[model samples]
Target: MAQALGAQTIYEIKQALHRCPVQLSRLVIHKTQDYALELVDYKVLVRLNPLCKALYLLFLQHPEGIVLKEMSLYKTELWNIYLQVCRHNDLKSAEKSVAELCNPLSNSIHEKIARIKSSFETLTDKHIAEYYIIAGARGKAKKIALPPNLIVWQ
Candidate 1:
């Protein structure tokens, strides 16, 4: 009789778990509208510093990944993205910011990437955040691990 009750309790617990709603977060990048980042399922906007946002968007665009040393190749693209995301109209300052990021001698790129990682980790679980972060080993290409289907670019 005790065994029967335990089995019934287990079945009830499973049923309860099945009934609970699971939230699947989808990241939506608003490309045409100021490069805004949004969690579609949660209806929340993720705020990243202008430069960090530009870096994140660049990674999102390149699923194949990007090497740190090769950032100079993307200086133009990054600068363009930064221009749209940044509220200020200081073109010279924005250009300088992108130049520093592409300069291997400076640690600006690393700092921006760290800030971008922190932004996502704060919004969700570490495992989930991994999908939204720029990560890779030294001397290898870094990329966001999120599935392409989960990312929506507008």
Candidate 2:
């Protein structure tokens, strides 16, 4: 029946079915002036590699995000050392905790921290901070307010 209606494959049919429930709900909500799609919460899981996990975890501990691209330029040596520490850790959990403990001073994780802060700042406008906070909080939903304003570059 799905194919007859122009869904090409079984995967397409499944995809359509998966999305139908949401679409139907949205359609019903559209009837109400107060309801909007932005209010709906949808989640997708991403599996991160060990290194990114370590980096992401470290960034979570900092109130400001890290700036990877700029940090790579200004603090190559410190970044290399941190990368080495990430490689030495056995488990992702240990890597995450150790990375936080290893760099308590903002100057210690300076470049990496800047990069992460920058990334989060960039995402603030798009409602991506919720995802970051969700990931950082390890799936614990915590209420977070967006920063006053993201720093804009010229």
Candidate 3:
């Protein structure tokens, strides 16, 4: 099936379909050589409305707990789709569309983090340490003064 629909042909089809503003399809096919998918089998998978909605909800509920690596992977995949969209449309328009789709979720995730911070007073130290880890910091660990009511998890 893949051989019958070559990557270039698939990409061209996606470009044409994308140009039709009324079309509802979310799938975007691109040349495999253009982007690398770390996991999942496909060059690009522009999730449909339902899956995207579900993911947004999950992200809202567990923003800090979500794995950063997985989010990075998903962003990379989406960026590839943005590149494909740009091929058929103007680059600025495609970038704006992708940003419009992604920015809200990004803001929501940040808001969730802020909510978590506000809910726990003594969590400041632990949360800061976690931020360092997420930022890929290296060096000796800094001592954190935890309040008596605060609980630290190893």
Best by lDDT: 1
Q: How close to the true structure is residue 116 of candidate 2, measured as C-alpha lDDT?
A: 45
Which candidate would rank higher by TM-score, 1 or 3? 1
**Candidate 1 per-residue C-alpha lDDT over 52-109 given as tens digits, one digit per residue, 9 for 90 to 100:** 9989988888999999999999998988888788886787888888999999889999
RMSD of 3: 23.0
lDDT of each: 0.85, 0.37, 0.34
Give candidates' CA RMSD values in order: 6.0, 15.9, 23.0
- Candidate 2 error regions (>4 Å): 1-46, 73-130, 133-154
- Candidate 2 per-residue lDDT over residues 75-94, each given as its tens digit: 33434434543455455565
Please give, for residues 40-149, the per-residue lDDT of candidate 3 as tens digits. Answer: 22122322232232233233323243453244435545555545323444666655544444463455434433343332223223333232111222232122122212
Ranking by lDDT: 1, 2, 3
Error of 2 at 54 (Å): 0.9
Residue-pair clash count for candidate 3: 0
